[model samples]
Target: MSLHKDHVVRWNGISLGLGGGVWGGSVCVRLLGWTQLNDLEIVLLLALFVITPLALPFVFFQNKGPLFSKWTALVVFLQPLAAFLGGASFFLPAGPLAATFAAGWGGFTGLLALLGLVQLCQMRRRHRLSLTELCLAGALLYLPAGGAWMVLACWGLQPLGFGVHTDLLTAVHFHVIPLAALVITGLTGQALHNRPATRRGVCWAAYRIAAIGVLIDPLLVAAGMTGAQITSLPDLDTVPADLLALSLILLTLLGLRFVVPTTVSRVAQVLLTLSYLTVFFTMLVAGTYVLGVTTGAWTITIAQMIAIHGLENALLFGCCGLIGWRLRTGQESQRSRRGEPCAY
Candidate 1:
């Protein structure tokens, strides 16, 4: 990335962040007398406004060659805008109107997922299946699934025997947890993609492990949710989810250990390391909570979970990780263009 390009990306991120902040604040303040939203829902709005806009450009713009087109760019632009409309719809008294706006957001996300699928097919035709591409595809494809859940939540239609609140929670879960993790991991993998053969192999191994874990975690959650209902076994929900969380935590910790030393900027290093460490602790706390659910020992309430895991995932891990990668890569690109020997 050129210095000029870097400025553009930064300006775009800041503008999106400010827009999201203002929109979120106004919706909350104005709609108070109409409908009261929960912490998790507010966090969902923040993830849509604050995180996704910042992430989409950083994650997909680099791959604009095959993955992004003019039409696709329009879709990307519409996604957040639609989400803003959907957020406001929550303040509306009518359920049908709320559901419709939410569906539009979901439709945009579904288009994004289709774009990701197209990218994968292009890669397949080229006989290239890299870890970075897989991560990018996973990140894009997961959004619509979350959007579908959001639509269902808005419609007050719980299909899988889960409550409307749980559907909404699942929407936030997919959007933040898997999507952010995939972006951060994909960006890290992209950084490592240009290394020497020996290190590149190692990088691929690390990325493959972590990416698989991140992608699978959501499926396991859904399976656990459905399985619990079918077999009348309550442990079905927590046991597999807790185990997967543990695996992801270990894999992420390992992946970070491999990638962090390669970062040349001290600021980027600190931020990335902090983001990785934040996920480690939060996932561990989540696993423990699941264990408590299984053993009847101790468990945090849903509100507490949202306050701790939800906020930390979006603010600390997602925001810090994406920005750190942008800084790290920007410095590397500048050094490379200057014909200087790059450290990492």
Candidate 2:
């Protein structure tokens, strides 16, 4: 068969499916030892094996051009395999060998980040401010930053001195919040791009605002975390969390505004709607948790937050939204082939 775009997507999905199976089996093995991985760890595995792969082909490597070569496409297609190796290595007995394999994933992510940076440079030269492009670039560059933290976590290094697992937590935070969230935002913007939006249209403006919020909030939060770590000022953490809360709330609410366009299949519509709804609810949970962090009110415990907020964002928002965008793109392709008017 020809190496068409759809075939690439299909092959990538298969690789990710196999990776996810390995992740599940590994988790089962760990659970049988009379203890279990925490919710955040489980969610991190899900992001690696599922969400990132699901979005990678459709969003990042969607088009073929001079800027996106066959080699780049091939590298992108193999991401799931890399993720599989990294995640499965976690189950290996701790040693230099395991660290080597785990670092392979980070190295692959670094390559992907380089691709994103190249694309961003091209966009900059063209003076384009496309929300989807910006978000995709930011998300790609952010993933390897998370991977670095994951490496430190695996090596048992804690930069913040909060705890042994803080690095792991930071890894998951970057992967889910910045990388996955921005990918979702980019997908959402892409779906609504055909809405009768000029440069200053409401939809266009919302996309820009959401992109800016998602891209900047993470860096600010990272800075705050570093400052808090250095100064032992807990209040430093609160400000970034507040900004994150605002950013997430605005991003999701704006997402809901464009969630239901008469432009795609009903299946896509339902999936997208549910995705945004899940995101909204999770952000509310996040907001409340931040409030507790700020006031020491402690309504939601860390365990509870991990269980509810982590799982919702990982399973519903990440999976549903990415798959929904895929369906919508397929629908648009069919319409275009049939010489029918397509919304996107």
Model 2: per-residue Cα lDDT over 1-344, one tens digit each: 33556677677778768767866775786678734555666777887888777767755566456767665667757777678767755565545666677688888778878888887888887898677788888877887877887777666666658564677677787888755688877766776665655335775776677667777777877888889889988778767666666666666776666555653689888888888788778877887887787778787887787777777887888888777877877787888899999762
Clashes of 2: 0
What digit string (tens of lDDT, one per residue) describes model 1 on residues 246-291? Answer: 6567656654766688888999989888888888888888887887
Poorly placed runs, candidate 2 (over 4 Å): 1-7, 26-36, 93-95, 197-199
Give TM-scores for every candidate, taking all chains together and pairing residue i with residue i.
Answer: 0.87, 0.90
Clashing pairs in 2: none
- lDDT score for residue 258 of model 1: 64
lDDT of 2: 0.73
